[model samples]
Target: MNVTGWQRDALLAVAEVVVLAVILVMALLGNGLVLVVLLRRRRHHNPLHLFMLNLCLADLVVALFQVLPQLVWDAKGRFPGPDFLCRLVKYLQVLGMFASSYMIVAMTVDRHYAICCPLQAHRSGATQRWNTFILLAWGLSLLLSLPQVFIFSRSEVAPGVYECWGNFAESWGLKAYVTWMTLAVFILPVVIITVCQPGPAASSAFCCPLPKAPTARGGEVSAAMSKTVRMTLVIVLVYSLCWAPFFSVQLWAAWDPDPPQNGAVFTLLMLLASLNSCTNPWIYSAFSSIQLYGKLINILCLVCLIQTLYFILYM
Candidate 1:
C-alpha cells in the first residue's frame, strides 16, 4: 500500500516525537544524576567539580527549556501559546546553549590551570574563582542571547497556527549571526579545549606532587591520571564531532540560500547535537569508580549505539 503524503508526514512527525521523548528523558535524568551526586559530595567541591556541577545545571536547563518545548511543539504541530512565550522559548533556548558551551570552556580553562600551573592553581582560591566564573558564564550567556528576544517573534505557520523562528531584519544578517555563533560558541571552544589538553607527565606531576615518592602507588596514580586525560580528550573529540555537523549544516545554509535536498541528514545532525548534552554525563560515568553508574553507562551506551546505527540505516 502506498502511503499518502499527509500520512507520511504524520508518521515522520510521530517518529520525531518518540525520539525526542527518549532524548528528553535521558538528558533530564543523566544531568540530574550528576547534579545530585556532586551536590551530595559538597565536601569535594573543587573548582573542577564545581564547574562540572554547573555544566549539569546548564544541561538540565537545556533539556527542560529547549528540548522539552520542541517535543511539545512537535506533538502539537504548532508553537503553542502567546507571542511572549514564543519569544521566551527562543530566548531561553539560545541562553541554555550559550551557557552550556561557556561552562565547558570554563572547565577546560580550570583543568588547564590545575594541570599546567598547579602552584598558582593552589594559591588562587579556586572555589571562589569558579563561583565567580559561573556567575560570569550565566551573565555572558544571557547577554549573548538577548538578541533572540528582538529577532524572534511568533510567525504564522498555517491560517491559525503559529511558530517561533528567527525573524532577522535581513537574510544576510541571519547568516552572519549564524556564522559568528557557530564559530564563537562551538568551534572556538573546541580549539581551546584541544590546547588545554594536559600532558600525562604534567598531569602526573601535578597529581602526585612527590617526584621521588614510592614507585608503585605513584605509578598507579600516574596511570589513573593518564587515563583521565585520555578520557577527557575522547570526550572533547566526541563533543566536536557531534556538534560540527550541525554547525556545518548551518554554515551551508548561510552560504547557500536553499535547504539541502537531504532533509533527513539535517535532522540527524540536529539529533546528534542534542545527544551531546546527554552523552557527557555518560562519559563522566565511564571514568568514575562507581560500579552501578558504570553499569548504567554501559547500558546507555548500548542504547545510543543501537540508535545511532538505526539513524545511519534510516538516512
Candidate 2:
C-alpha cells in the first residue's frame, strides 16, 4: 500500500509519544532517586555528585519543557508556535543539550581525578579544586549559549514547528548560533575528548606502579581505576553514539528541508536520534549499579528502548 509521508509520520509520532511517556516515568523515578540520594548525604559530598544531580534535573526539564511540548505539537499536526514561543522552545532545547554535554565532560574529569590520581584525589584539598572546575563547566555552557537565544525564533514557513538552530552557512540570522554550537558542542568538545583520551592511560602508567614493590592496596587501586576508566569510556561512547547520528541527520535535514521525505530511512534516522534522551539514564546505570535499584531501572529502561524501537523497525 502506498503511504504518504504524513501518514507514516503520524504513525511514528504516536510511537514517539508512547516512548516519551515511558521515558518520562522512568526518568522521573531515576532522577528523583538521584535527588534523594544526593540530598540525603551531607557528609560525603563531592563536586561530581553535585554535577550529576544537576544533570538529572536538567534532563528532567528537557523532557517536561521541550519534549512534551514537541509531542503535543506532533499530535496536533501543527507547529502551533508564535515567534517568541518558538524562541523560548529553542532556548529550552539548547540549554538542555548544552548542559547535558558539559555534565558528561565534568563527570569524565571527576573519574580522571579519582581513578588516575588517587593521591591527588585525596591530597591538598584536591576535591575542592575540582568543585571549582565543575562551577566553571556550568558557567561556560551558559555563556556559550547566550548569543543563540537572540538569533533563535520560529519560522512562518510550512505547517510544521520549526525552531531556528545554528546557521552552518552564511545565513546571518542563523550564523551566530551555528558558529557557537559548532565550536562548543561539536568541534571543541570532540577534539578535547579525543586528545584527553591518552590522559587515563598515562595516569595508569604512572599510578599502577610495578610489581617489584607490591603494596597491599595497589591491586585494589588498580581495579578501581580500571572500572573507572571503563565507565568514563562508556560515557563518551554513549554520548557519541546518540549525538553523532543526530547531528548528521540534522545537518542534512537543514541542507535539504525535505530529508524525511527522502525516504523512510531518513525518517527512521530522526526517530532513532531522538531516542538518545531516553537512553541517557540507562547508560549511567549500566555498570554503575551500586544498588539493586540500578539493576531494576536499567532493565526497565532497556525494555522501554526495545519496545520504542519496535514500531519503527518492524513497521
Candidate 3:
C-alpha cells in the first residue's frame, strides 16, 4: 500500500509506459486506416456510417490526448512540460469517455428504430433525421463533459511533478460527482442500450419468452436479427461486467474511508474498462458476419477502441 518504495511502483510504471506506447501505435494506425477508408468510400453520408466515423475520430483523439500522457505521468510521477498540458489531458479523457458512451447508446437506438420502426426508418426523411441524431449525440457529449474543463486545474505537487485528477481527496462534492458520473457514464448506458437493442423478439413479449428464429423473405431480417442479438449480448455483458466493479469501487472510494488495497483493485477496474476498447473492435470484426461493410466497421472500431482502452488503463 505504501507507494513510497521506488522499486514497487517503478517496475509497474515501466510496464505502463511500454504498454501505453504500444496502445498508441495500434490506435493511430488502426483508426487512421479506418478514417481514410470511411472518407474515401463516401459512406459517411449514411447515418450509421457517419456516427461511426466520428466515433472513431473521437476515440482517436482520446488515445493521443489521454492514454499517452497517462502512462508517462504515472511512470515519471509528474507530467513534463507545461501545467496546462496535464489539465488538457484529463479534460479530454472525460470528454472522450462520455462521448464514447453516448455514441454506443446512439448506435443502439439507431438500430432499434431500424428494426422496431422499420416503416418510419426507411422513409425519405430518415437520412436527414439520422444526421440530426448524430449531431445531437455529439453536441450532448460536448455539453456533458464541459464541466470537466472547469473542474481541472494543473498542480505541481512536487519539485517536478504535476497532478490533474487531484484534490478530490477532500471535496465530498467531488466524490459525489464521481459516483454519479460512473453511474451515468457506465451503468445507465449499458442498461438502456441492451434493452433498446434491435434483436428479434423472443417467443413472448407478453407470455412465455420463447426464442424465435427470424423468418426472412429475402431481406436482412434473419441475419440482422441474429447479429443484433449476438452483438447486444456480447457488448452489454462485457461492458457491464467490466465496468460495474470499477464504478462500485469508485462509489466505495467516494463513501468509504479505506483507500484501494495496493491500488491493484483500481488498476484492475481500469484494465477491465480498457478491455472494452480492444475487445469491442474484435467483437465487431467477429460478429458482423460476412457483410461487405463488416471489414470497414471492424477496422474502424478496433482502431478507436484499442487506443481508448489504453488510456482507460493507464489513466
Top TM-score prediction, candidate number = 1
| Model 2 misplacement above 4 A | 1-5, 46-48, 81-83, 114-124, 158-183, 198-201, 204-216, 256-262, 271-274, 292-315
Ten residues in a row with the worst lDDT in model 2? Answer: 165-174
Q: What is the lDDT of residue 265 in candidate 3?
A: 43
Per-residue lDDT for 287 in model 3? Answer: 60
Better candidate number, 2 or 3, judged by TM-score: 3
CA lDDT scores, all candidates in order? 0.77, 0.63, 0.64
Q: Sort by TM-score, best first: what order?
A: 1, 3, 2
Residues 1-315, model 3: lDDT tens digits: 566666766765676677667766665655555566567866435554565567667667667666767767767766665657755676777777777677777777776666565555667477776777678777877787767665777776777555664555466876878877887788788777867765345222312232444544636665666666577567667767756776777777778778664474465455345434433444444564324345657767998999999989999
What's the true lDDT of residue 100 in model 1? 85
| Each model's Cα RMSD | 7.7, 7.4, 8.2
Tens-digit per-residue lDDT, 272-309, candidate 1: 67777787787777776434375558778999999999
Q: What's the CA RMSD of model 3 in angstroms?
A: 8.2
Off by over 4 Å in 1: 1-3, 157-160, 200-224, 291-315
Model 2, 1-315: lDDT tens digits are: 457766876687777667656756666666666666666764676554566667776677666666676676656755576777766776776666777777767776666556555565677476686677677777776776565567655654446536443333455434344444656775676666664553646566545343354578988867756765676677678678867775666666555535664454565555443455555555555555435375566868999999989978998
Give candidate 1's whole-model lDDT.
0.77
Q: Model 3 clash pairs? A: 203-210
Stronger candidate by TM-score (1 vs 3) = 1
